[model samples]
Target: MITQKAKYALRALTALADADADEPVMISDIAAQQKIPKKFLEQILLDLKHHGIVVSRRGKQGGYLLLKPAHTITFGEILRIVDGPIAPLPCLSITAYRRCDDCDGEQNCQIRHVFAKVADATRKVLFSTTIADAAQPTHSAEVTRLLA
Candidate 1:
């Protein structure tokens, strides 16, 4: 399962996506609107800014905005940024692959085989779905179909 931090990051990104493209959103506004804690959101946004996913403004009218288009930012990208690898098992992770300590060989590991398929399917959906998609009202049906 994705961590709460990941969930909050997704929600925050969607909120940003829903805002005016040229306008910046204050952290307090996002925290209140999305029900995320202000302190936690500050940390999350700082991380996102460091990753180049978002950019911040300064001064009176200053705030935060997406550095890239919402459609170009995939859910998988955010999850990987906030939660690390998306795989269910270390052996199945594409970005952070490591052999299981107890496993003798990947070729003969039944668990790895099953989870590899799961990881592939999960990656397909997550990488294909974007922050813009999540902001849409009809995205649920499309996401469900992708999983199906």
Candidate 2:
């Protein structure tokens, strides 16, 4: 299940991605548009900025903008940033791995073996589908594009 924070992060990113890349969007604007709490969004955006996912500017017309292109930012990357490892189990994690206390041998663990395949498939799909894809316009344009 996706956490509310991670959902906010994805929605916020999609909102920003849908806007002009050259301009930054204010947190309040994003919050109102995405129906997210302003305070919660502030913290999330700050974390994203720290991770180089987004950048902020200050002055009269200041706000946040993507540090990289939407197409370059994957769902997996955002999820990993806001949440943690994509693996279902800690033992199956590549980036945040730790030996499962119940397991005698990692390679010999049947549970691990099954989940490893599931994790791999999930990771592949998440990593390939970018924020740009998620932010794609809906309605007739989306329908035509899908048909094409």
Candidate 3:
């Protein structure tokens, strides 16, 4: 399951994507527009900023913006930043791979095979799906509806 932090991070990133990429967006404005709690959004955005997923500006006109193009920033990357690994099981994670402690023989384990397939499919979709793809007008309704 996706955490609230990841969801908010994605929402805020989508808002940033919709805005002029060069122009920073006010945190308060993003929180209000995206219906995310300001305090929580602050922490999430800060995490993103630290991860180089987003950049922050300081001053009267300061705000946040994506450091990279939205299309280049995948949901997998964002989720990893906010939610840690993309795979449900550590053994199935490509970036955060770890052997299942319960399994002495993963090569022969049916459950491990199943989780590996699940992880692969999940990663394929997530890695292909970028913030820009999630921000598209065509998909915006579905995404927003899901979030709501």
Best by TM-score: 1
Error of 1 at 133 (Å): 0.1
For TM-score, candidate 1 versus 2, the one ahead is 1
Off by over 4 Å in 3: 138-148
> Which order, best to worst by lDDT?
1, 2, 3
Order of models, best TM-score first: 1, 2, 3
- The clash count for each model shown is 0, 0, 0
Clashing pairs in 1: none
TM-score against truth, every candidate: 0.96, 0.90, 0.89
lDDT of 3 by residue, 30-137 (tens): 999999999999999988989888899999889999999998998888998888888878888777788888888878988888877888877877777789978888
> Of 2 and 3, which scores higher on lDDT?
2
Per-candidate Cα lDDT values, in order, are: 0.93, 0.88, 0.87
Which ranges in model 2 have alpha carbons more than 4 Å from their true place?
Answer: 138-148
| Residue pair clashes in candidate 2 | none
lDDT of 1 by residue, 8-116 (tens): 9999999999999899999999999999999999999999999999999997888999999988999999999999999999988889998888999999999889988
- Which candidate leads the pack in lDDT? 1
TM-score-wise, the better of 2 and 3 is 2
Report how far residue 64 has shifted in candidate 2, in Å. 0.9
